[model samples]
Target: MNLLVRRLFWISFAVCGTVSLVWGHDVGEGDLKVTVLAKSSDAWDDKPLPHYPTGQPEITVLKIIIPEGKKTPLHFHSVINAAVLLKGEVDVHMPAGETKKLKAGESLIEVVDKAHWGENVGQGDAEFLVFYAGEKGEKITHVLHGDETPEAVLQEANR
Candidate 1:
């Protein structure tokens, strides 16, 4: 019967619509998208990442907030680390005076056993997430005071 055929057609249409809606569309379809922000074995400074330490592996994630116009303490990380800038702009400087600038949504693989620091240069707080790979009982970050020199910091970090 005509009515029976019409019902089947409508049901098929509805099912197809539901399937498309649930599965969504791919990149070319413009319904969803993905991006590779960063991928590398070297830090932003072009230095190769250090070898993993021996012992119980530990992974640490830190959410750091730097107030506008403020600077973080000069410090060094003993292990390999990376970061994604979530908000505002910041400039990271190495003890040797080299600098790397970053803005919101940007990422950087950080230097290991090197003294460096960051300054929030934007109009708002600079926020970032840092991921560290290290071993248990090992200190990841070593902060240096105004009186401490970069050489001292590096020596401490290497030790």
Candidate 2:
């Protein structure tokens, strides 16, 4: 009877230990969550980022606000730039007719040296944080007149 009782105790202990090891660990929720918006080796158009000018790097960050129904002039970034929409919605249009709509909490890796424009399409004001990776004294953006072609712009930039 003593041997049987001892055997039963050991078996129960082993079963309880195994069950605790398998199911007793805590799986608690975290306070904050992070989502990656964009991760790319190239720009939106699949082109490599342009080389930074030979000088100390200059970084520029701007909080741009676009009133409802407003549109940006056709322009292009000479340096690598990106933006994260903070408040509302915007339609980004390229000269080649491609368009992308970005909303709050979304981010974009903008095209470099490509002509494009942005229009606020939301009911309220649109806001975004634009960041430029450039060199000091270099022009970060070039706004085009209505009739200018990208070829002409590139030529002027080279001269």
Candidate 3:
């Protein structure tokens, strides 16, 4: 009986492992549609997208949290990004001197070669889930440090 139980346990483990491998989480098709604007752009002159990618694809899941009165500074992702705001309000500043407000449950598809800055515009912290698609080895963001630029800030963070 002890040997039989051990064998059954091993079988169950193997089955579970196989199932997990075979059934990877499916990225929703609707999610892909959100970033169509960025993905469809022909000019990818941003820091991360020096050249259009043409091979293996990569997906990055980004969870950004901005504390009250804190800002995300100015930056952009290397690949096209589709994002959904989870909490609070965030103001996105375009390089062209335009600002747009995004609230919880709202989504955005940023265009390629665009520079931007983000700030928490609400009284509380704001959170967001961002999905990006690009090549494996690309720089995701460029920091504009000049005060004159619309999205100027110190030290750029790239992922």
lDDT of 2: 0.76
Candidate 2: clashing pairs of residues = none
Clashes of 2: 0
Expressed as tens digits, the lDDT of each residue in 77-152 for candidate 1 is 8887778899999999997789999999998889887789999999989999887767777888888887776468
How should the candidates be ordered by lDDT, best one leading?
Answer: 1, 2, 3
Q: Which ten residues in a row have the lowest lDDT in candidate 2?
A: 8-17
Provide the lDDT at 124 for model 3.
89
**Local distance difference test values of all predictions, in order:** 0.78, 0.76, 0.59
- Superior candidate under lDDT, 1 versus 3: 1
Model 1 C-alpha RMSD to native = 15.3
lDDT of 2 by residue, 35-154 (tens): 556666477777776554555556678899999999999988887777889999999999788998899989888888889989999989999988776667788888999788666887
All candidates: CA RMSD (Å): 15.3, 18.9, 13.4
Error of 2 at 110 (Å): 0.4
For candidate 3, write residues 1-159 as lDDT tens digits.
454345434433432334443334465523222222123223322323234356455556778899988887666555665677889998888767777788887766655556677889887889987766666766555555555332232123321
